[model samples]
Target: MDTSSIVILDFGSQYTQLIARRIREQNVFSVVLPCTAKIDEIQAQNPLAIILSGGPCSVYDADAPPADPEVLNLGLPVLGICYGLQFITHHLGGKVSPAPRREYGHAEVELIDRANPLFSEIPANIHVWMSHGDEALELPPGFHLTAKTANAVAGIANPERRIWAVQFHPEVHHTKQGSALLRNFLFSIVGAKPDWTPGHFIQSTVTAIRKKVGSGHAICALSGGVDSSVAAVLVNQAIGGQLTCVFVNNGVLRRDEFQKVQRNMRDNLGLNLVAVDASERFLAKLAGVTDPETKRKIIGNEFIAVFDDEAHRIAKQTGGVDWLVQGTLYPDVIESSSVKGPSQTIKSHHNVGGLPETMKLKLIEPLRDLFKDEVRRIGRDLHMPDDILQRQPFPGPGLAVRILGEVTPERVALLQEADDIVVAEIKAAGLYQQIWQSFAVLLPVKSVGVMGDQRTYAYTCAIRAVHSEDGMTADWVPLPYEVLKTISSRIVNEVRGINRVVYDITSKPPGTIEWE
Candidate 1:
């Protein structure tokens, strides 16, 4: 089925993806293209509307990002965000210059044109989140003012041209009416219908997958994580018995994750799953590897090797396997690279399994266009257990990335124990679902501590918990003092090797979620 898409042109803004996310939340599909996209490229989506994303550049600056002015001449309903507004005004015979006092945070917008469909039924005064330094001093040709702040223009419109633009961001939560404003643009202005649902997605994706993999069998590397697990199930629905799901134990998984994932995939979910205990195999390859990148490579190569062998065996049974299903999400596709900006759209899902080139298998990424939350909705529609859909995000290398130093079996066991305690404590406090990730890291440096009146030098366990809508940005979660105390005391008393437990409070800007 042909879907109505709203095309968003990227102008190098940090909030560009957020604009796409907001539109997708409305059940009207949207696509993002770099600002450098040609006019015909913008036309290729058959866009119902064109959204210009906010960027960090100024129109008058010599180094400002490139844009196709012809995009406005296409006669599509146009909505411009922060930099988008300035870009439109500057290109259409309007004056744009630095504001006397820049608006960088929350501001109040007073709607002047109440009858405009873009502001239909919205309150006259609204609290909006602003981040622009430039202000429109004069109206563009045929454009009239629709809204304004005390210091700057907030909204403008040229109804005959079917274009509207806003100075404040309508995609962020800081603006209380952000969603409502976007809802107005999508429905009242652009006439988009909310037809994108999980059920619709499942039906469409299954049809597409079946059409692509007609006579060829597809094999999935199921990590037991939600992304892979959901991908495996979606593929199974398409190919039935032809899809073989392989779950390999890389030895660095969380405590009992191997058996737990096995139960969920095989006994509970009824997938034709093949479980391989390559724990010993992977641990040996990572034996003394300490550098994070080296450990990651060794683990990834070993996984590819293990999965390849399994694929070869399965191929022999099914005549041949021709596709590899991956649980790649849209965020992975968005942030995978840069095209002279914060991000550029990645054309393909990063090989989820890092399979060898010789395998010559085609890629089937059912969830590549979806966000994590959207994937969960599809999982629910498929009747997948909450345990599988709600599982926290885990790194590709699993606990190897959690452990700061050597990848030894003993350290793995120690971190797993401490990690389990951290999760258990968080869950007991009813914080498991609220927090993004709650895990323990095994630090390489151990400190001296008194245990049972004996001085002991043991490994230090660092407890890390974070809050984020996506893993791309996160803030350290301040688990309650009591909860932290419980996690710390339990790790010290229960885990034999760890004498000290510390909490990580770093956010994503200066530090990543993981220690490595």
Candidate 2:
């Protein structure tokens, strides 16, 4: 065993990654492996404990994913959650049956064994999130029921065998005792220590980069947003003067984004930054290209070409650098996993991916595994400015996505003006921090209206604001009616764009906040 790590086996559950997050919160490192992982691979990882994640499928289903029997026989502490509990019980000669009434929400759990390590410090009856359709009728030999709910057994433990199982989800906030229960299992029952932290991560990455680069230089594509800026700072800290940052202004950014970004790069972070004005090139290429997907593809391709040309120029001038750095995050990696599948072909991601293999430079991505909130925390720890760290997320494709149909210099200017008004009004109302994402969308259709006794016809605008912990799921924020009225009136009167304005009220399941 590595004596420092845990392995979470994913069974295609939405909360599988949450299990790993919870483990990391305890300071113990964790990795998610496919449930069909080989016995040899599991052994090679030498995990201190193995956690099986819940899945959508019932254990009795014909094609349900199963765990390797060799994993159970390795004498390591094992914890099974939700469907995982059913799988363990069924594999060990126990009985499982579909529930007559499936439990799907909050439930009260009572711990029968007060002395049990997993329930020692917790209360007797605690709230837990339960989502399951199957229940275990009986436990395997040597295992005894440790906890129960009003309807069925809630948990089981075999102390001698170092195995435990729970039918409830302990990784969600809806379960008040979830964190405590997981801490007990990871620390008390399995004897794992918490050592994962940003410091450890920074040191490890520095060591890895040193070994990989061996005094070579690298270049960064800084977009002035949180992601690329933070990435540049991290790489600069690691490699010192060997890293150069290149910031491009494609003429589609928000009001004054370019200037503020330059000040940030030069003054605060003290990076060797190159400011390239490619607005003319981008505007030329985007002329008459109205399709959203087409705009994204052209922008992505142009961004690569620009960066490549700059990198080659710098390399030629500075003895030939050997690496490229980017600010790709964990969610970006997860969503882009199926690049060759139908999903990738249909969806348009603003970030640039699929870098050329023909380029001689190797790649360095330090923030690949971090969530957005975690990235913000790292930036704070590094003493980055609050304005840059808390800045709203803007798509790499910029105002192009905000414009529904056509791409033109005039249209870009109009959208930028309207977007500026939205940002300014939201900030004045002190609601910027409360909202996860807020932006203005420009519509191609125009409405007729009169301003100061003059007839005017311009593009319509839509206000989109959403609240989310993670971008994966979100709910539209319900701004005060007065605030909405104020914003709508100001945009129509101040900006010369559109006549009509509307607010998007759709939730994430039915609608994504982004119009494109």
Candidate 2, lDDT over the whole model:
0.83
TM-score of each: 0.94, 0.93
> How accurate locally, in lDDT, is each candidate?
0.88, 0.83
RMSD of each: 2.6, 2.5
Model 1 gets an lDDT of: 0.88
Quote model 2's TM-score: 0.93
Question: Candidate 2: which pairs clash?
Answer: 27-194, 27-195
The stretch of ten residues in a row with the least summed lDDT in candidate 2 is 337-346
Please give, for residues 307-425, the per-residue lDDT of candidate 2 as tens digits. Answer: 77788888887798788888988756644431122342444676545556666777788788777777887788778998889988788889888888877888888888888888888
Q: Give lDDT tens digits, candidate 1, residues 12-116.
A: 778878899899999999888888878877778778999998988889999987787888888989999999999999999999999998999899999999899
